[model samples]
Target: MATVVPEESTASTEVKAHEVRPPRKPSASQIAAARSLPNNNEAVWPAFTTKLPSSLYIDEDRFDEEHRKLFMTLPLPLAPSALLAEPGSFVCRDGFGQSVILTRDKDGKVHALVNSCRHRGSRVTENDEPAKGRLMICPYHAWSYDLSGKLMAVPRREVFGELDKSELGMVKLPCVEKGGIIWVKMDHEANDDFSHVSDELVADFDALGVADMHMFALRKHEVEGNWKLILDTFLEGYHVIRLHVQTVGPLYEDTVVQVDRLGSHLRQTSARVGFTKDILAQNEESVDDLRRVVTYVYTLLPNVAFICSQDYCNMLVMQPKGVGKTIVHNFMLTNVNPQSEKLRQKWEKSLELTDGLAFPEDFSASAATYQGLTTGVVKELMIGGMEVAMEHYHEMIEEMVARA
Candidate 1:
């Protein structure tokens, strides 16, 4: 079951703040990016245009290559650490074409185990909900395993002569919890080195207090589009003013974003509508109110996009199911849990605005783009200078796929 935060009515008209950790000052790199953001009037088009073949989105061979080389091999973000914050808690996630059981042991160590039982191949956990217990009892034969994937009990063990419990533990994948996200490599033979999750990315997430945030809600979206096409939405701001004009466009500056590359990952910082260069000039050393003026979008290569706003962060894990299908797991994380009615209402409203209104706009655009490409009339898609981030993203993907 989904964890629920208790909401109580408050008599005070003023909003009471929830208990949270101290706000972190913007990192040096983040502050520098903020200072370098171009004003709306100073924004200029890119000097060159890049063209990507439509086959890249609709071709089965291209999709299969990416699936094997990138998605299967890399350390993909599975879920927020907050989801398994409590000891003995577990959550089942099947977004990456694999049923994974994420658990927090009594000692608070996180583990990613295959959901299949060692006995009859039945799923140990039957549903995708946050559950807590000492043992994960398989429904097939009541075979149970501990939170760390250690086999604990088996029914009628004497019936099976010389059963080896030690060798029958659940299969564990290479998992690491960093920057408040759980990352797991899907392929058993893939390299376990997590060097691809760079320190720069962790520092940025740490500065944003991503590790300590409370998970407000998580929802799964089945999008009728390629995963890369869905990711392209967050890589560029060119579509905001045009595509999101009715929803969130009025709050953003037109095509003015500061793009920075952190190894394979990418970070985009853009000023909000009322933002001015003077804000950076006043706060030279540190950005006291960074999210208020600037929106940070970090793309963790292959499958994750972490978008930061003033009150909460949106972590999107786009799992490609096919050339034309993607499963997007959206997680909304807040600095603190909503303890009062006012706070609860505030978060609910934010969730409704983004998930209900804004995200539909972005998702539909990706679907429409996919539909158009599938018709085969358009041989190539044009990438403008303002959307240079998309070019960088695609290049990084191609480079990773080329690796031996």
Candidate 2:
């Protein structure tokens, strides 16, 4: 059954609502820090190269611009129902900070809704609670909306005054699910259609040969850097030899990275290290179990990274927390092994191992880069040849922000 994600369950609605709060007046020290922050206008564009500036890692203004231009305007893709694997399944994503309700309804539709109620604006759903049937009742004002977001009933509309149910339905974002991914435009005009964003997505994810996988394990953490910084960490494998020497460097070819672009979409590929001999000696029959494989890394428009491997896959989603903070979600998956408990355990173990290995390295690099970039030591950034993919990503962002 295809899962329909209701509008409020979308990540964009969740994150934006979460981002909406009374702005905090900066304290004296904070203001001082901001004023003292480096502004190397001359260094903003370095000589022709492939390496981006370390300053970009922590620029306050640039970070703010990204929030307004990228997240607020661009649409991000979500995991599809095929990825959810079953009815009654749901994942409570911390959309930056907003609570987003993602569930497979009884009719097999996926619903992404803001957890807030339409009446008093209180959070209506918790992270894991599932609402069944054709309607969802707000826990706060008892206002109820149907699966399609129509205001079905309110407790005292007739007694107090006839409320306009037609205008009180939950807000819905533009969303479409395919290829085991759900995609939504965050702040598009009401009539904007997002289904045409990707030619490949239009063809369907299953048709792309990457469906039927179930999440084996999911891990998330808070990083003290902009979401772009966290995303950039995964954009190129150039740092593998240096930052991830103890982990990924041992299994990935850090020197060679390839890239492709589709409008705002981007893709990269890196040769998975550690098993060249195995692949050379193995026949087609043994391809599925080989440890080292060519990994396909892709970013769909805004901020999603996916690494599809032979037997399993991994996704790293970057959600912004604020100007200089981000929340990272790492989901590792594999085809559901219906008959073997050992295989399932292996999948779980692989996820734990990968997460434990990669996160510490990424965090340390991102934090250092963030702090270092805050210093006004440089003018322009350099994006060297090795990190061309990352450079392309920044170029796309710059173009979008400039237009916005």
**Best-matching candidate per lDDT:** 1
lDDT of 2 by residue, 1-404 (tens): 00000111112222333222222232222122222212222112223565566545566676667777666566566554444556655544557345655656556676666656778787655644233455667777788766656678888677758567898776666666656776655552434556436664333234323455566666777887767777777776657766766665554443344466654677564444332433423422232322123344667656777765545667777787776677777766654432355455555555654677666577667767676666767555556656667778888877877896
lDDT of each: 0.81, 0.56
TM-score (all chains, Cα) for each model: 0.94, 0.75
Which ranges of candidate 2 are over 4 A from the true structure?
A: 1-48, 51-55, 80-84, 87-92, 96-99, 128-135, 201-204, 274-292, 337-339, 378-381
* Local lDDT at 320 for model 2: 77
lDDT of 1 by residue, 1-404 (tens): 00011112233324555444465777888888888876656666666788999999999999988888887888988888888879879989886667899999989999989889999888999658789899999988999999999899988999989999999999999999988989898875666799888888888887787888899999888999999999998888788767877776665556467788886799888776656788656654433267666778889998888888766788888988899999888899987877777677877877877777777788899999999999999999998877877888899988999993
Candidate 2 lDDT score relative to the true structure:
0.56
Candidate 1 CA-lDDT value:
0.81
